[model samples]
Target: MAVIIKPFSLTVEDYLKQEEKAIDKSEWIQGKIIKMAGASANHNRLTLNLSRLLPLERGEQNYEIFVSDMRLWIEESQSYVYPDVMVIQGEPEFTDSQQMAVTNPCFIAEILSPSTAGFDKSQKFTLYRSIPQLQEYLLIDQKSYRVELYRKVGERQWLFTEFIGKDAIVELEIVNIQIAFSELYKRVKF
Candidate 1:
């Protein structure tokens, strides 16, 4: 005889209720809530650097910047994710009538950690592409100054670019700002 066990499931409403009180962040997918690991020192530094480097120019045709704490809803997957950094142009669309989760992000940047790099590059990136208004995606290395940018050019086409070394600079086209790798890696010990 073989023994088997079933995974636990939760409705989106229940997941949100739990998430509101949870100390740490969790990703809700399908029907299960996956708890994310605490960010490393390097990861934390990079995330902060990335956010700080983003230009705060807001008036007309500007973007709203959000840190990782904000929850993002992927309508296609019915999953909620927290990107390291997010940029929303104009107004952001919320998930529920209560306006709990964001459904639109013009640009998203994810700081790569050893544990989540593979998932961020594959599943998470694919999930983010489902957003019709997403124009750019960035994968930034936490331990080093490597960055990969994907810019959406056509309806279904995307252009890829990579920048490396401390002297490199990534041009945030959506916001018309450039971020230097040196600045982005500041205070990052690794």
Candidate 2:
């Protein structure tokens, strides 16, 4: 007979302590620790493009842009996730004095991979909405020239917009910036 042992769940504090010393990145969701996977070449390219473009485009705007390294704390869900790209308008709010985790992000962009696409669009998006300071959520496709935006329109309401093809431009009114698909997908071969 085959034996199946359940995995042990870690407390939020335990996870944080271990994650600090750990070499790789992992996410904590409701006491379950989920290991993050490596990004593909295309995924890395897209992430780099956005991280670079967002800062340059927002001229004179007080926005801090962080790539995949920074961790985001979702208090409502008791979860910690590292978004592909995060844009904080004005000052950023950290979860603790350690400053490893941020509590506020005005805009977040996730580059989609086949393995995480479903979660990013559904459950992840749901959790992000719980953050009061989050104004815009963006999803970029690494496999194609596609981008999805969800802007907070009202209390518990979001306006969705899609940009397709190379010519499509993603206009973020909150940040007063427009990014072309050509620029976002630059050097990213599908």
Candidate 3:
């Protein structure tokens, strides 16, 4: 499918207003609004697997995990983001108009897409790190059976780890849980 490239000019407020009326998923980044591309079978599988696993595992009182659709807000950068899977802990400060967007999320996951892999790894990672409360960021590869995890270390540094194969287990330090790689790809076809 040919991507419909919309010129970047809308202010953050305008982008939010326009997004409310949009029929499909889109994200506003640095004044440029980009439409979300359709997900691949592997991407869909990974998203569904995380959505099911996180909520059941994350303690009810501490966090709420959501699939795609919920927005993540970065106030300093004046940008809004929609993550593949996000886990938010604590009482979030929300805007009356942006009740759907989350101000703070402890963990955020993004499954790679061909059209978005570069941005997700570089730009989006940089932007997500700015979130003061974000403790972990996950990037799952659709083509390869790998998951790259970044855990926050201090005010400005983060630690990285990668998991692959059925023997591997993914760790979420923020919530104190371990998820087996095999469990995540249980029903996923290679």
Candidate 4:
């Protein structure tokens, strides 16, 4: 038989118990907690633009929309993430505490950068896949007007679609919502 090493598992509760102090920023991937990188002005604007549209399209509904600063907990993989933009429907699942963590999200969007693109597309996307409630995952390019959408078709499969050009629009089938290209790249200087 081949040698097999069981993967370590870390729960949201145990992860929080490790550190009571808060750093500038951090992310939990698998069982490893990593620091978050600072965003550029363009990145910040794109993230803001995306966050602004969610609630408007969703209305005063039960969904929650969060920007870069918020943390999201993935229950399955036992990881916590801070996506550039996050939207969750239904009631707030997690309780309010000093070390609170988000358990589920219906949608998540990340603005791509050269540094984080690989992680976002491969590593981060792999982690995001573990979230059972994640319906759609979006990757927005700041250098150009390109939006890539991954809509879930089944429990473990995601359908990929890409939108290009400034006039293009991206639609999320999961949430039954559409957003303009201009809205995503608003105030974003090339």
Winner by lDDT? 2
Identify the runs in model 1 with alpha carbons over 4 angstroms from their true place.
Answer: 1-6, 97-99
Best by TM-score: 2
Residues 1-190, model 4: lDDT tens digits: 0111234545556656653476545666677656665788888899888887776344455677777777787766667777888787876467356536576788989989887887888977888888778889999998899888998898788899989999998887656667898787889999
Task: List ranges where model 3 is wrong by over 4 Å.
Answer: 1-5, 56-61
Residue lDDT tens for model 1, 10-129: 899898889889997788876767777777888888888888887666555866789888899999899998888998888778876776679899899998887788888887899999
lDDT of model 1, residue 11 = 94
Supply candidate 3's per-residue lDDT for 35. 78
Candidates in order, TM-scores: namely: 0.90, 0.92, 0.90, 0.84
Q: Model 4 — TM-score against the truth?
A: 0.84
In model 1, which range of ten residues has the least summed lDDT? Answer: 1-10
lDDT of 3 by residue, 1-190 (tens): 1123478678888988888798887788777777776777788899998877774444556667778888887887778778899887766566565477887888999988777778888988999999899999999877767999999999889999998876788988877778888878877777
- By lDDT, the better pick of 1 and 4 is 1
Which is better, 2 or 3, measured by lDDT? 2
Comparing 1 and 2 by TM-score, which wins?
2
Q: Per-model C-alpha lDDT, please?
A: 0.84, 0.86, 0.80, 0.76
